[model samples]
Target: MGQNTNIRGIVQAAVAMTTVGTLTAVSATVSRYPVYGGQAVRYAVAAVILLGVARLRGPRPGPSARWEWPLLAALAATGLAGFNVCIVEGTRYTSPATIGTVVGSVPVVLAVAAPLMEGRRPAARIVAAAAVVTAGAALANGLGGGSLPGLLLALGALAGEVCFSLLALPLLPRLGAVRVSAYSAAAAVPMLLAAGLAVDGTSVLRVPTRGEVAGLGYLSLVVTAGAFIVWYDALGRIGADRAGLFAGLIPVSAVATTMVLGLRSPGMAELGGALLVGLGVIVGLRRSAERPLAVAAPADHHDPAHDEEGHQDQAHDDQHPEDRRFVAEKAADHGV
Candidate 1:
């Protein structure tokens, strides 16, 4: 069962990488539209897609009580709006590849925050591996060159991602990954729109070009809505930290896509960076073995079948209120 849980975690990580691909595409495509107008278009489309998904997930009368609501809002807000701001604002200082390399630092951020999020003492191996990954990210993105600002932005984004996921943990059990993600995406829409209005004024409301429309469609349907659902569902089954390790693949896939389409060519530095990222991933997976997970976070509320037979070091006993609460919390925790 533990092995299966790990495998599911790997699956979730892979799905997460795929989701990030869609996001990266959306980011590049949005560039085709005028600055402010493009952002408004992106959010308007994302909002509609999330609204549809919210309908399918069904709504609860109130917010998820699994955690304090305000904290959860901050977490969701970071992912939804903060990530965007970081990327957009961060880009002003750096190139996209530099962003990728910096974004790759997420594993390190996860490793750092893991203690707080899951109550686990990170092993030495994890620390070493995280260092390697960060180094790889720096090299991959040309940190020594004019890419310094971009690298900083990328690191900031990585940090934001770490905060978003860790802070989001408590909310998962009750809000469900679907509702939580949808609400986050939905909330970002207005803030994004406001930012767009501030920058582009009435221009943001104008009709988009054909390329812009295509980009919008791709982002709304496939990237934001579809991939978000898949990624979070996997999160429910597995756990966030495990799910994050797969992010190493995003830069690889992104670079490959561009190369294949003749949009860009790979240079020696980029190739070396890929090698470092690969090594970092290998080290990360290895580190997971050296240390026993200190604190078992919990399970997903969406699937009771995932509950371990002897969960929370307690036998299942309906008569005991404490035991029942343990099981309930375990079940809702979404394998955190």
Candidate 2:
């Protein structure tokens, strides 16, 4: 099971890299489109796609409590709206490479925050790997000139990236990955629209060009709707600390996209950074030989048909009470 989880994490990480990398490349077209306007369109379309997916998937496979709404809203606000706004607004003042370098520290942020949030220090090797990933991000992005405002905006983006996964952990057992993703995207639409109106004025209401529309579609459907589901699913399976390290691949993927698009060939720094990010992923994903997972009790002690579902339940139960409360609240709805 651990091996399978690691494999899934690797696949999910690849998907995430592809998602953000495509965003980096596609965003070049948005130079003509107002940033906020582009984001508003992206989330709106994403919400629509997610809503359809939610409907098709039927009701979530478990009971739910209304209390999960606030967490979902926060996830939408920070991860979807605030994060994109920071990147877009930040880019106006600084280069995308600068933004990428700042955002690349997401694993480090998660590693540090894990102790505060979960009351356990991350593995030393994991923290070291995260640092290596951060260094790779800087090198791959070729850290260069940036203003104070741009740096601050990039920090805001970093905050959003951290919040996205951390915020989802508490709700994973209750809502399931797809539903959590769907709800967040749906909730973010209004937030993004209001932000777009504030930032871009009447321009937000204008029809986008065909090229902009293409970019918007890809961002909405592929990056948001598709990537969010995969990311949260992997987070549930493998845990966030290990999964977050994979985020380092975003810069590498960006370099790959550039090479494919013939924008520019990667230099020594990019190649070396890509290798470091790969090494970090390998080191971070390795399970400790001395600290094997506790063996589960006999099947007779659990529901025979529910063995698969039990793992996810145990994952949630291992969290802090604050993290477990959402599940407890929803379990109460089922009288469990």
Candidate 3:
């Protein structure tokens, strides 16, 4: 493995774990504030906190460039709107365990997309690693226990996540992580509010409990604002493939948290599934280091964790001859 790729692999691993952790925390909190409008309110609040931080530290988003608006739209669609709605609705339709399994496929998506989008091919080792991750996720979902729709909902969430990762690419380099997060977060509010108003008019006036308020505060201040900066910065440096891998951590955290809250203990299948994902990530990432041209920027120069690839080119076409032929055309040179 080249030193550069090795570092990126580590970054992606960390981000993936953190991503899962954030989801576990936020989702548990959401049990308190289930309203549709809550999405916007939380992000709006988070954006404010991010902006405050931006003022104190230098902003991650620089003067900026062309990729801002489209990236913002992507964030609004994937992160703010679709992501929230899907999770809530999906949960209503299916089981969280099943959904977690399906959502876990993101690493596979990235594993496939990375090569094709980069206008290159993935090392055989990477493909193997991705396959392992995919299989592990399937095992987790299948054994974790849920209905068919439950599985589908999980897949749906994964679909949204894939879209979010691909779409967020273009914005990272120009905006920096924090600026992009804050802007998209702020931008998402109007739509969230509209959804709430359209679906439930009294959403605005509903009384919030102490837990709900605290949940909202955490979602906004910590999850949306704080985590995003770190995540986006990771995305910018390491490329989405590595960043997406962070997703595996979510199920692990969820299971652990569930146990902690005394909701349920991790089942054998879930544990096996999580272990599979962890193994797959380790294999794929380490293999990436060994392969030539595996990451965006040289890891030695910049933190491998930085996101460098354009979000649009997030696929790892190494195994997918079935993928669209022109994926590479839109690809930005990562870490150049």
lDDT of 3: 0.64
Single out the weakest 10-residue window by summed lDDT for candidate 1: 292-301
| TM-score-best of 2 and 3 | 2
Off-target runs (Cα >4 Å) in candidate 2 are 61-66, 290-336
- What is the lDDT ranking, best to worst? 2, 3, 1
- Runs in model 3 lying further than 4 Å from the true structure: 1-16, 59-67, 141-155, 287-294, 297-336
| Best of the candidates, lDDT | 2
Query: What TM-score would every model get versus the actual structure?
Result: 0.77, 0.84, 0.76
Give the Å error, residue 69, model 3. Answer: 0.9
> Candidate 2 residues 1-336, lDDT tens each?
355555765687568766777677878776688777677777777777876876886544432446688888999899888998898789889998899899999988886775456555567887899998888878988986699999999999999999998998777765677678778887887887788788777877678888877877888888888898788777765667777888888888888987899998999999999888888878876767423222112221234246576687776554545446655777799999
- In order, the Cα lDDT scores of the candidates are 0.61, 0.76, 0.64
lDDT for 247 in candidate 1 is 64
**How many residue pairs collide in each prediction?**
4, 0, 27
Q: lDDT tens string, model 1, 14-69?
A: 76675565455455655656565565455557667776666775545346455455
Worst 10 contiguous positions by lDDT, candidate 3: 292-301
